[model samples]
Target chain A: MLTIHTKLISAMITQSLKDHPIETCGIIAGLAGSNLPLRLIPMRNVAQSENFFMFDPQQQLQVWKEMSARHEEPVVIYHSHTGSEAYPSRSDVELAAEPQAHYVIIPTCSPHKEEIRSFRIVDQMVIEERVQIVRQYQPELEFQMMVA
Target chain B: MSITVIIPTILRPLTHQQKHIDMEGSRVSEIIDHMDQQYPGIKEKLVANGNAHRFINIYVNDNDIRFQDGLATSLRDGDVLTILPAVAGG
Candidate 1:
């Protein structure tokens, strides 16, 4: 399962819509090995193709350096599908490099309605997972609420 | 000069599951050619028609080779080379 902040989801959807016809791609970085996504980094689709997207190489390099300096990893690698369903395409499966990162897909074909989904693609296999959106991640509050 | 080449997970199988490999080359293309010699079938995945594949992104010491000299990008002895696919969908 994947747990993400609502604000991040909102930002992703907004960006996806704003870049309609061309897919938007970005990474949500978090503490290394923490598995907690906290940062929403919108990236440029250098390909700028309606059928595909590719991050600007220079920008990607810079972001990667920043993430390394901050001791972070891409907890959530996300992109939008403007013409297809929220499923990993053949190329997506072939290019999935992060086995530990959650692959989030926001389908904006209709623009009126959205179906967001997350998957784990490792070695050409795609496994859909549940997503829990929270306004805030409060591990301490969870225990207190459980006891209350 | 010897450089460290970090292989991405997708290409790990072709690399005998090796994550990192040390090879000798001064230019990015030379290193890629050497890698292909060591692990057959890898060059095709990384290069196509004498150019880095459209989906492949190679970086040297945190800087993308595309912004530099691409396949002709020069390397130093302790430089770290990373190969990753372009993250995209839709």
Candidate 2:
């Protein structure tokens, strides 16, 4: 079971959904610590989509290099379903380049139905996992809330 | 009592483009009932005939109601219910 820093990722995803509600996508950068122990950081989102999120090869490489510089591993690649269920389509599984990366799906089927779910897509197979969302308010967001 | 329900982006079309709505209820279930009375097919998407939808989650003041009373979760004045869509990308 993979635990998610719920509030942090949720905020990122909420913004992504609203920003690119049509087809939002991004990358999750974090430590891959395990019994094996992999420490990584400097998470940045490399937003992409199948038909809508094609990034230039150079841009992709740049992001990967950035990840390397930060010692962060590709823990997961997330995108929204956008008016559909949170299950991976055949195309999503076929494009699972990172067997180690968890393919997270954010279903924007209904604004009133905000739910976040994660999955692992490997070898054209989808293995679902539960994520624990731990919300820590960004100082800016906190201040805004306080002021309001 | 009547409270306002905020619908997320994905589910807005179903709500006829109205982002915010007012409904009457003492509990979450009652609010849902009031919404169903206003919009015909809404409750079906929210509560699967009997149980809540597998993909939908209801939050009151940013706290997930699933950890609370499910549909029976109580509501009060000035309370905000944000209907968030389950997002799966990253």
Candidate 3:
């Protein structure tokens, strides 16, 4: 099980909203052990839908390549529902092809309020998992993680 | 009582393009075995040996089977089993 910093996740969602108001999604890749350390890897947007996302295969491969270069595997995938609950729609569940990765959704249903949720997409099931975002700053950083 | 198993698009090849299949079993494992018998080689897409594919996620009703008994998860009459893919989009 991986644990993500809630504050970092919040920042990602907030930035995603601004970057792709229509709908935004990305990947989080990191080491699988200790602190469950992770790095958010933004993916191509799954063009807007009535209440779902349509993922892009080409982008997926690109992200996969990037992770491979860094020896990091995709651990979670995140998207935003501009005006719906942070839950997987029937379509979302049907299209989840990577069972090992987590599906995270950021719901912008309520104006001025943003909500983030994470789930595990198993064959025929969507499992909600626990996520934590920390609030701290470590300047003079040697490693730079992308949040766009 | 038998339940209907909904096969996702990615898995339709295993079911000959049938979206829904009916089977009878008290546990998920039994249902999988039943499917294997009905459709030769179907088990390869679902379970490997006595375990399930790491990417396949099973759900009873709307809850994830992982939180339940996994392959041993129980089923009741009229329950719905959905087999979905692990999609990676936005």
Q: Which candidate is the best by TM-score?
A: 1
Question: What lDDT, from 0 to 1, does candidate 3 have?
Answer: 0.67
Expressed as tens digits, the lDDT of each residue in A79-110 for candidate 3 is 77776678887767766765667777887657
1 or 3: which has the higher lDDT? 1
Candidates' interface RMSDs, in order?
Answer: 2.3, 13.3, 11.2
Ordered from best to worst lDDT, the candidate numbers read 1, 3, 2
Go through the candidates in order and give each one's DockQ.
Answer: 0.52, 0.01, 0.12
Colliding pairs, model 1: none
Regions of model 1 farther than 4 Å from truth:
A139-148, B9-21, B36-44, B67-69
Q: Give TM-scores of the second chain, every candidate.
A: 0.97, 0.87, 0.89
Model 1 chain B scores worst on lDDT over the 10 consecutive residues at B81-90
Q: After superposition, how far is residue B89 of candidate 2 from its true place, in Å?
A: 9.9
For residues A1-148, write the lDDT of model 2, one tens digit per residue: 6655544465546755674455666565554432111222212233444233322333344455465566655666666676667777766765565666767676766762457677877656889987765454345533322110
Strongest candidate by lDDT: 1
lDDT of 3 at A69: 68
> For residue B7, what is the lDDT in candidate 2?
73
> How many clashes in candidate 2?
29
**Candidate 2 Cα deviation (angstroms), residue B65:** 51
lDDT for each candidate structure: 0.84, 0.59, 0.67
How big is the positional error of residue B5 in model 3, measured in Å on the Cα after superposition? 30
Judge candidate 2 at residue A65 and give its lDDT.
47
lDDT of 1 by residue, A1-100 (tens): 9988777788889888898888888998888888878777888998797777778877877787688788887889998888888888887787787888
Q: How far out, in Å, is residue B19 in model 2?
A: 50
